[model samples]
Target: MTLKLAIQSIGVVYGDLGTSPLYVMSGIFPDGIKHEDDILGALSLIFYSIVLIGLIKYVFIVLSANDNGDGGTFALYSLICRYAKASLTPNQQAEDKEVSNYRLEVPSRRLRWASAMKSLLENSKAAKYLLLVVTMLGTAMVIGDGILTPCISVLSAVGGIKKAARSLGDDQIMWISVVILIFLFQVQRFGTHKVGYSFAPILSLWFLNIALIGIYNFVKYDSSVIKAVNPLYIVQYFMKNKKEAWISLGGVILCLTGSEALFADLGHFNILSIRLSSCLVVFPSIILTYFGQAAYLRKHAEDVASTFYSSIPKTVYWPTFVIAVMAAIIASQAMISATFAIVKQSLALGCFPTVKVVHTSRKHEGQIYIPEVNTLLMLACVGVTLGFKTTLKLGNAYGIAVIFVFNVTSTFLVIVMVMIWKTNILLIILYVLTIGLTEFMFLSSVLYKFLEGGYVPLVFTAMMVTIMFIWNYGYRKKYEYELENKVSREALVTIMSNTNIHRVPGVALFYTELVHGISPMFTQYVTNVSSLHSIVVFVSIKSLPISKVPLEERFIFRQVEPEESGLYQCVVRYGYRDAKMERQFFEKVLIDRLKDHIQNDVAPATDKQGEPSDHGIAKVNEESVQKVIGVLDEAIKSGGIMYLMGEREVIASSGSGLAKRFVINCLFNWLKRCVRQQEEVFNIPHKRLLKVGITYEV
Candidate 1:
C-alpha cells in the first residue's frame, strides 16, 4: 500500500484514537479555564501524557515489541504464546506439573520466581479478560460513534450556513443529521466496495486538515506552549484543590482514550504508517490544537468549552465542520472495522463461539470476517445514538473500559515479552516503569467521568466480562466432558477386530464431537446386534486456529479398517473460515479415494456438487477399484483401524475399545438425560437439548 493508503487506514482505524482532541482538550478545562495556571497545567498534563503514554509507551516502546511485525492485544498474545509455550513446554514437562498454568519469570532470578508466579498468571488472565472486555466496549463506543458521525458530520456541516446567517435553532442540526444518517444506513446494505477506494483518500485528507490546523496553531504559538510539559504541574493542580484537578484529569485524559486504539488495531494498519502519522501528523496536530485551546482558554476562561467554536473566525467554521464530519465518519468506520477484527481474532483464538464470517476480498483473506458482527455493531451504534443524544455525553462515558484494557495490556505485554523473547534487562525495566506510570495517569483521569458519564464504560465492560465468562466457561465445560469420556484410535481399531458382531455391509457413520478422544456427541448405547462389512466412520470436525492446526491443513480425514465386523471408520475436519463441506473436500484432492472406497465413478470431471451423472458404485474402473477395496481389506485384517485427526486431531484416540466405553458412558448419559429433560417438560421423551447452536452432529 502507498503512504496515502497507509495514512487513510490510520485516519480510519486510528481516527477514534487520533481525534481524541475533539473532546479531550476541552475536557481538561470543562469548568472553564479560569486562570493561566490552570490552562497551562492541563495543557502540560495533556502534552507529557501524550509523550509518555501515546508516543513512548505505545508508539515507541510497546509497538517495538511487535510480534511477527503485528500489533494488537490479540497479535501480541499469539506471538507471546508461541514464545512462552516453547520455553515452558520443556520446563513444564520436566519440572512439576503442579503449576497447571505456565509461568513467565526471569530465567536467572530464582528469588523472584516464587513471588512473581502468582502475579504472572494473575496478570496474564487479567490482561486477556480486560482486553477482551475493553475491546468489546470499544466496539460499543463505535456504535455510539457510527450514528453520531453520520448525524453530526452531515448536520454540523449543513448547520453552519443557516446558523451563521439566519436561524440558529437545534432543529436544523437535528433534521440534517437524521436525514444523512438514514441515507448512509440504507446504502450500507449495498456494501462499501464501490466507494471504499475513494473514501480512503478523503479520509487521508481528513487527517491532513487536522494536521494543517495544528500546524497553524504551532506557527502562531511557536515554542511558547512548550513550557507546559511537566508531570508535577498536573500533580500540583490536584495538590492545590484535589477535587477540581482530579476531575480535570478525566477530561484531559480523554485526549488519549483512542490513543490505545493505535496498538489495539495493529493488525489493520502497518507499524511505520501508524508510528509516522501519529508522531508527525496525528500527534503534533493534537498537541498544537490542545496548546492553541490552552492559549484560547487562558485568554478566555468564561468561554472555555462552551461556545468555544465561536472563538475561531467565522470564515473557517464550514471548513471545521467539513473536517469534523470527515473525521467522525472515518472514526466511526474505524471502530466498526476494529470490532470486526476483534471478532475474527476471537474466533481464531477460540475465545468466541462460531459465527458467520464472510471474506469480501480475494487480495487479503484477513480483510473481512463476519456480516452478523457488522449488522450487530450497526444496530448497537444506531441504538446508542438515539439513546445518548449527543457525542459529548457519550464521551464522558467512553474511556474507562478502553483505559482498563490499556493498562492491563501494558502489564501483560511486558510479561509476555519477558517470557517469549530475549531483550535487555534495562529496556524491560524501563518499559514496566514507563507503561505503568502512563497507565496510572490515564486511569486517574478517567475517574472524573465516573458519576458524570464514566458509568457507560462500566456497563460496557460488565457486558463484555459477562460474555467472556460465558464463552470461556461453556468451552471449558465442553472440553471437560470430552476429556472425561473420549477414547483412542488404536483402541477403536482393536475393538473392531475383536468383536464378532455381524450386520449391514454399508458405511457406518459414527457421530463424534470434533474434539479429542471419542466425543460424547454420538449415540453410545450399543446393546443389539449390528451389521458387518460396514465401515464406521468416527467423524470429527473443527474450526481452525483454535486448534494447533493451520487453516490450510484443517480439513483432514482418517480411515478405519476391515475388522471382524468388516467395518471401516473415517473422520473429517473443517476450519472456521472454510467453505462448504463438499467443496473443500474435493479441493483437497480426495475425489479418487471417495470414488474407489464408495465404488462410484462419474464423468471425466466431477461438477461442483460432487454429483456423478449416473450415481452408482458400478461406475468405477476395474483396476483402480480393486486397489481401493484391497487397501481397505488389508487395513481391516492387519490394523483394523485408521486414525482421523485434525492439525489438533480434535479427537485423540488411543485404543479402539477405549472410545466404545466413552460412547457408552457419556453420550448415552447425555441422551438419557436429554430425554428425561424433555419428558419432564412435555410429559414425553423428545428432548435433545433442542440442538440450538450445535456446530456439528455425529
Candidate 2:
C-alpha cells in the first residue's frame, strides 16, 4: 500500500507542486523591478509566502491531523468530531464527579457532516447521482489545464526573445503554447500511463533548475532581501500597496494549484509523506525560484525583454526552456490528475449522479481516467490556450478554482476542528484566523491577473457549483416522492395479530431505512407478531462513503451479533470515493449465535437451496428464498405467532438507492411467486402495508 501510494504521489498528486516554476515568480513581482535591489523585495515576498502559507500552514498544521489514518475533508471531520467531543473550555472543564457520572460521547463531527451530506444524498435521488457528474466535469477542466501549463511555462522560459528583441512583439512564445496543447490532446489515445513516468523526472529537473537559479541570485545580490521572512513584510506590503497587494494574492495562490488535492487524496497517501514532500522538498525550491526570478528582474529592469525569461543565465538557455516546458506539462498533468481525483471524490460523496467509475489500473485508485472527462478537458484547455496567448495571462485566469477549493476545505476544517473536535475556543479561533489570513493574502495576489484574464477558472468553478446544486436538489425531491411517513407505535401495534402471523424456520431478511433512531414501525410489527425465528437478518445498505473512496476502502461491512428483538444484522458502507450501485453486501455476512451457534455469511449471490444453516454455502440461492421466514417454534401458541411471523421481510435504507430498489423489486417478485404457488403467504409492500386499526391524534 505504501509503495503504491508513493508512486501515485510522485506520478499524479505533485504535478501542480512541481509546475510552480512556470509563472509563479513572473506573476507575483513587478516588471519594473528589473534591477537587483527592488527585485529582491519581490523575491523576498514570493519565497516568504511559500514558506509561511504553503509549507507551515497547509502541510504542517492542516495535513497533520489526518483522522487515524484517513486524510481529506471527511477524515478530518472524523478527527474534529473526536476533538469536538473531547473539546472542553477552561472555565467549563469537567469535574471528576461529572466525568464519572456523565461522560458525553460527542458524536463525530466528521461523521455528522458526512451524515448531513449522506442524508442530503439519501433523501434526494438526483443528489445521489450528482456526485458522479460534477466530479467528471472537474476532471475535464483539469486535463485542459495540463496541456496549457507546459507550453506556457516552457515557452515563457525560452522566450528570451522579447528581452532579446528588446521586450517587444514576439508571438513565438504564444504559438508554442498552442502547439503544446495540440500535443497534449494527441497523446490522449495512448493514455498517460506510459508517458507518466517521464513526468516526475522532468518535474524534478524543473525544481532543481529553479532551486539552483534562486541560490545563485541570492548569493550574487543583496542578501538582505531575506528580511522578507518576517510576516511583517507581507503586512507592510499590504499596508503600502493595499489594492495591488490584495490583487496580487490571486497570482500567488496559483502556486498552490492542487492544494485541495491533498485533502481529496488523503485516503490514497499517508499524511506524513505528503507533508514532508511539500514542506521539505517542494516548498523551499519554489520559494527560491520565485526569489531568483525577482532578483533577475531587479537587476535587469531597463531590459523589459520579459521578466519571465531574464531570470535564468544565457548559457543554460535551451536546457532551461526544456526544463520549464516539462514543468508546465507536469503542472497541467497534476491539474488533470487532481481533477480526476476530485470528481471521483465528489461522486463518492453523493454530490452528482450516474458516473461510471472504471478502475483502469489495479495499482492505485488515483490511476483512473474517465473517457468522458478526458475528451472534455482536451477541448476546454484548447479554448484556454487560444483565448489567452501567454502564460502570464493564463496565470490570471487559472486560480479561481484554487480559491474555491481552498475556502471549502478550510471551512470544513474549522467546522470539524472547532465545533467538531470541540478544541479550545482560543486555539480554534486562532487557527481559523490563520487560514483566513492566508486566503486573503493569496486572493490579493491573483487580482492583478483577473482583469489581466482571470475569468476562466471562475467560469469552470461556477459551472461545477451550479451542477452540484442541481444534482443535490433533484435527488431530495425524488426521495420526498417515495417516502412513507409512519403513524405512532401504538397505532401500528394495534394492527398486528397472531392470526395474521405465518412463521418459518430458515432466514428472514427484513429491509428498512434507519434514519437517526430505530424504526418504530418495524419495532412494533416484530413484537406484535408472536414469532419464533431461528435467524432474523436485518440488512442495511449505508451508502455514505463516496464513489471516490479509493478501491481499497470501497466495499466494507461490519456485522453485529444478534441484539434486542432477536435480529442478526449486517451493514454495508461506502465513503466519498466509491461509485456505482451494487447488489448484495459486497461479500459480507451476518451471524446467528442464539440457536445453533452457527456463523452466518451473506453471499453476494443467492443462497444455496436445501442447505441447512450448518452448511454455509459460498453462494446465496436467490431462487429458493424468494421469501424465507425462519422460526424456532417449540410450542403451539408461540408457533402460530412465530410461524405466521414469516409474513414479512425487513431491510434498511443504507444500501445504494438503486441497489435498494433492485432488492425490493426482487423481494416483491418472490412474494408474487409464492402467491402463484398457492402457498399461504402475506404479500404486501412495506409502504402500503399498514397496522389494522389503532389511530392516533397528532
Scored by TM-score, the top model is 1
Query: Who wins the lDDT comparison?
Result: 1
| Model 1: lDDT to the true structure | 0.51
Candidate 1 residue-wise lDDT, 17-124, digit = tens: 555656565556655555567666777777887887888778877766664445666655554443333111111122211222223333444335333533554457
Cα deviation of 323 in candidate 1 (Å)? Answer: 3.0
TM-score, one value per model: 0.70, 0.63
TM-score of 2: 0.63
What lDDT score belongs to each candidate, Candidate 1 first?
0.51, 0.50
**Every model's Cα RMSD, please?**
10.7, 12.8
**Residue 402 displacement in candidate 2 (angstroms):** 2.3
Superposed model 1: Cα runs more than 4 Å off: 1-5, 84-197, 217-223, 230-236, 239-241, 306-308, 369-371, 422-429, 488-491, 494-515, 522-626, 629-698
